[model samples]
Structure formats: structure tokens, C-alpha cells
Target: MSLVSALAIYFIIWWMVLFAILPIGVVTQEEAGEVTPGTESSAPGRPQLLKKALLTTLVAGVLFAGIYWLRVHSGLTLDDLPFKPPSAR
Candidate 1:
């Protein structure tokens, strides 16, 4: 995999993991509308949903970067080697 391919894979994997569970970790309470667990007043009217989304994305991005590094060093990237078409064989 080249740099582009690695980046693509990382983003795909990261977002997949993030959204497979929940795009936003926030949840709505019966009266509060949207709140985190064990919290009250919903943090004084902040954008809880957006905050969760940003946090999830930030964490995913870091994880993706790590995976990209691992993939690049796993000896699977094709950058250092040349390839030939099947017909050339």
C-alpha cells in the first residue's frame, strides 16, 4: 500500500468503527432531551451531540494514524517494489 492507500484504509476503518457503534455517544433522557450518563441539566445547554461527535472523530483519527503507521511498517506496502502485469509473465 502506498501513502494514499494507507490513509484511505485508516479513515475507512476508523469511521467504520466509530459509526458502527454510534456516531454520537450522547443519549437523550426523558426530561433533559440529551445528556451523558449520570449527569444532570445536560451540561447547562451545550451542544452535547456535536461534542460527542467531535470527540469520537478525534479519537478515531489518532487510532487511524496508529494503524496507518503499523500498516506502512508491516512490509505489505508496494512502494519499494516494482510490479508487472500478468501478461508480462
Candidate 2:
């Protein structure tokens, strides 16, 4: 894949992985018994966003590498999809 296409795919994978990792090891204010007066009880007491972001990057990199390897080494491509383009008819 071209650099731009690869970067775009990686960006998408990183965001998806970030969302997936966001809830891991979370501690809500309610769960920690430290809900502030003005904030929702469900709000995270310690978001640890930096740590989660780092983990997300690592996971996304590995996943992207696997997908890239599959695309290059296994000859997988959009043509393998079940549907066909109108022009192919």
C-alpha cells in the first residue's frame, strides 16, 4: 500500500483501538466512593488517558502490521469481497 493509504488505515485502526481500550481498568467516582458534588457519579475518578493511549498505540500498531502482512503476503484485496462493482457486470 502507498504511504498515504497505510497512514490512513493506521489512523482508523488507532482510533478504533483507543475506543476499545478506553474502558479498561476504569474507576468511576461511584465505585471509588469519591463522587464530587458537581460531577456525575459515573465519571472516571482516574482516567489514566496517557497510559491507555500508549497501550492503544501499541495494540493498533500490532494489528496494523498483521493486516498489512496479510494484504501483501497473502494476496488479500478488495476483490475478495462477496459483492461486485457495477462495471464488473
Q: Each prediction's Cα RMSD?
A: 9.0, 3.0
Could you tell me the lDDT of residue 2 within candidate 1? Answer: 81
Each candidate structure's count of clashing pairs: 1, 0
Lowest summed lDDT window (length 10), candidate 1: 23-32
**Model 2 lDDT tens row, 1-89:** 99999999999999999999999999999999999999999999999999999999999999999999999889989888788557843
Pairs of residues at least 3 apart in sequence or in different chains that clash in candidate 2:
none
Best by lDDT: 2
Q: Per-residue lDDT of 35-87 in model 1, one digit per residue for the tens?
A: 56677654543446565566667877788777666666665555656876568
Tell me the whole-model lDDT of each prediction, alpha carbons only: 0.63, 0.96
Best by TM-score: 2
lDDT value, residue 65 of candidate 2: 98
Instruction: Candidate 1: list runs displaced more than 4 Å.
Output: 20-25, 31-47, 74-89
TM-score of each: 0.44, 0.84
Clashes of 2: 0
